[model samples]
Target: MRFFSQRRRPFLSVVICIHDMAREAPRTILSACCPYQKNVSPEDYEVIVVDNGSAVPFALRDGAGLSPAPRIVSMPHPRPSPVFALNWAARHVARGNHILFAIDGARIFSDQLIANTLRAHSICTDAFVYTLGCHLGPSVQMVSTTQGYNEDVEDRLIAESGWPAKPSALYNISVFAGSSSNGFWKPIVESNAFSVPRQLLDKMGGFHESFASSGGGLANLEIFARYVQRPDAKNVCLLSDMTFHQVHGGVATSAKVQHSTFAQEYFSIFQREYRFPSFDAIYLGPLRPEAAKFARIGLAE
Candidate 1:
């Protein structure tokens, strides 16, 4: 998603879109807003929660802990396409030099996720940066973990611990594999969360709102493909940071339920597979001790 014109600010605005995630909303919002340390000043980053036509009307009350808190926006009607809500938010309310899109509303993030991303962006301003995706289950494996995803299991575990999400907990559960030459950080199939200069996304005409599919997978892939394919754009993957997905019967990631029909439809329309970035990621390696310490603060007990 993009904002038109040439307005630049020093800070970042994160837009998170949710359809119906009342239970997972609190944890997700808080996790993003409650980072322990910021590479940039707290005021440099803002979070925007877009309740895209959820039946329960997701609230921004959990954001009270932030210095400025997060702003809440809503879609006028329920739409199968998350793209509609995303474009709506980007058009009306985003205020940042760069905009980061987090499509899933039900995610608990590492404390270092935002700070680390900001650090990368500050260093490589022209680059497109994205977080390493993780799913919440027995471990913090990649989003496409073979164990699959189970919302019930995640809910029960979090409820028993009574902790929202903490650095230590995230560390304990994180899993890694060597898909690349180095160990640890592997190549990601898709990035659910990514950051880009507002102008760049705008130049691409924002998100294509034609996707009326269950989860807007085609829209996401199309937007990301353009970003990756840009020859001058550096693609940086924040290795230390990860976004832990909380299952909400996701149209794309729900392992138990297959989206073959949706996939076929998407293929027929595009005449190709959802293009994964062909380039290897710019990996800066593992989390530092100080960053890990800072991350611990985001967790709730």
Candidate 2:
């Protein structure tokens, strides 16, 4: 069932950076490396989790349910530099021709995310891909949750009888599309779930290392602004998937706008040099089961 029966590189390398997400790391890792994920096999993708100096470092057991278990890296110092953490992990990747970067380690992904993205990437070499990023928490409860999405509420819903918690199925994905620079369906400027070719990632110089903002360098946003509009890049927005964030005391997501001094500083710097992509994505239709390319893995289109 492994994708790499031979010696070829994996289809993708999932790189996740963590600062202090002890509560959410396990869920994030499990979701990404779950044996049940049909989109891509354990052999087809490499999962790397970098713990950037948390009080309690991430520990993995010998036989975690995750096959080809996740590779764990612990940093010595605690710096609010997810940008650096990501590049550090990227440098350590030994396989996988493509890179799947998760800006936040708290995100629990849908099982089909990999399969759907792989299909899109495999078919279109020039398109820039983005899976919808959904904030999980009460709508308007935090700066991050523009809408009601309480994780506890979601958990309660899932725990109920006949709940829709199947990991292999395609999950609800919000589509927001609009025209920009004569292009339709622009990717959200701050999406946390996105995949890019290793070569293209290198071409973009990875995440910008200069920002060093208190809260994640906001380098994730900066990178998207520059590349999606590149004269040569192809922007492709996936309408049937999502990366659900786990509610935590996130720096930007939890902090009040007036209290977000670091974010303000970073934004000032960002605006001085970059113009954000006009729109996140072209608003399409509501969620439907037709979005999933693979029913489970081999069920076929």
TM-score list, all predictions: 0.81, 0.76
- Where model 2 places Cα greater than 4 Å from the true spot, the runs are 1-8, 61-63, 76-78, 140-158, 161-165, 168-187, 256-264, 267-274, 279-287, 290-301
Tell me the deviation in Å of residue 70 in model 2: 1.0
**TM-score, structure 1 vs. true:** 0.81
Predicted candidate 2 versus true structure: per-residue lDDT over 207-296, tens digit per residue: 777767655645777777776777756766665566666666676566533434544656677565444575333222233464443113
Every candidate's lDDT:
0.67, 0.61
Global CA lDDT of candidate 2, please?
A: 0.61
- Runs off by more than 4 Å, candidate 1: 5-10, 35-40, 139-152, 159-165, 174-186, 255-257, 289-301
What are the per-model C-alpha RMSD values against the true structure? 6.0, 7.4
lDDT of candidate 1 over 110-141, digit per residue (tens): 67677777877878877788765555566433
Model 2: worst 10 consecutive residues (lDDT sum): 174-183
187, model 1: CA deviation in Å? Answer: 3.5
